[model samples]
Target: MDPLQAAVLQQFFEYPFEIDQTYQQGLAGILANNPSNTVLLNTRVFYFNRLTGSSITVADVLAYKEQSASASESVPPSNSAANDSKEQPNVLTFAQLQELIESGRLDEIPNNKTISGELNSAPPSQSAVSVRRKPWETSNDSSNIMES
Candidate 1:
């Protein structure tokens, strides 16, 4: 199973009987109308069947959590190194810098002097495009297109 599923199952296994009952009831209520192929439904069904005061083995849960934690810890160092190499100082794109200059809003660009130098050195193809407005600006229109 995936780490997230394992984590959730681990949590469910560790919960007190009363808390588990409450959680099961809440899950049942949520899935009362539609009960098909859901994780919550599946978990509820499993725990319900095994609720006859039987002790469950949590070795798998503990081992899975430890393995996942170790794997995650090992992975971040390499990812952080790659991210450090890729990191660059924040700078406005050529188009935005130009727009700010034309609209007399140059002050809006943070570290403008540094950004301007970088933008001037970069090719025209690297410029950022302005955002376009959506066709439907407001949701108050009462007319239905299906009526006509």
Candidate 2:
């Protein structure tokens, strides 16, 4: 597909594109060498799911955005701050980390040295469950299985 068509279709669909490190590095090098040229790269594209197969208008999207903004605003500031502090660690691949950095969400990058380590650090430990139970198998004592 032509770049123009891809640009147009980006508004409605999340199409696959070259996001590999080598391609990005090459693009960056080209841009660095030619500062006069304007490069428009779409790193992320969001498309709403059509569960009901219903047509969606721009107004619908706008209304949904407005509603979400208002809802977030209704959340208490203290609660928001708490949420930020207690944010769960995100396990991300190198490519994903690069994408986050490029998208300007550096804070989302996990800094938990205990969970993950630097490139030179040892590999992450494997997680093993203390108890392994089959889905079809049940405990002999069924008293606590159904509680009021």
Candidate 3:
């Protein structure tokens, strides 16, 4: 495994609850340690699982990175570095990713729509009631009633 990948794994294990923070720390560490490797920096992929609130496996990162690289490679090259810069994938911030996931932009993950629908379609709950009669109170019956 790559040194950066190993470091990422270590950070994630250390702080399992802070997925985004761990990812950011890992990226910063990698960039700090190897500033010259623009390819590594630009090609990195962070696969966050919102449901589990955790980062996915390194294999997922590798897969996404490969996909991103292939997609970028297909685009035509330009003379200007600005154009190349534009071609590079924009790494999504945690907030943006969270918004997208919550907004249902990523349909691959299940959302609460189904649950809401079920709740809406279900019958309303009936409350049970207990009735009590006082000992002094008597039923209206002419035959059983005593003359006053």
Which has the greatest lDDT?
Answer: 1
- Cα lDDT tens digits for candidate 2, 1-148: 3455334434433322233344444444444434321131221121222322334445444454355457678766577456533422234666887898899887786542334555756878888857788786677666456542
Candidate 3: misplaced stretches above 4 Å? 1-79, 107-148
Q: For candidate 3, which ten residues in a row score worst on lDDT?
A: 43-52
TM-score of 2: 0.18
Order the candidate numbers by lDDT, best to worst: 1, 3, 2
Check candidate 2 and list the clashing pairs. none
Question: What order do you get sorting by TM-score, best first?
Answer: 3, 1, 2
Backbone clash pairs for candidate 3 read none
Q: What TM-score would every model get versus the actual structure?
A: 0.20, 0.18, 0.22
Q: Which is the better candidate, 1 or 3, if ranked by lDDT?
A: 1
Top candidate when judged by TM-score against the true structure: 3
Task: Check candidate 1 and list the clashing pairs.
Answer: none
Worst 10 residues of 2 by lDDT: 37-46
Q: State the lDDT of candidate 1 residue by residue for 6-113, as single tens digits.
A: 656566545553345465455545544554334443554456437634333344444664666687786555674464334322345568778988999977975446
Lowest summed lDDT across 10 adjacent residues in model 1 is found at 83-92
Rate residue 118 of model 2 by lDDT.
50
List candidate 1 stretches off by more than 4 Å: 1-86, 113-148
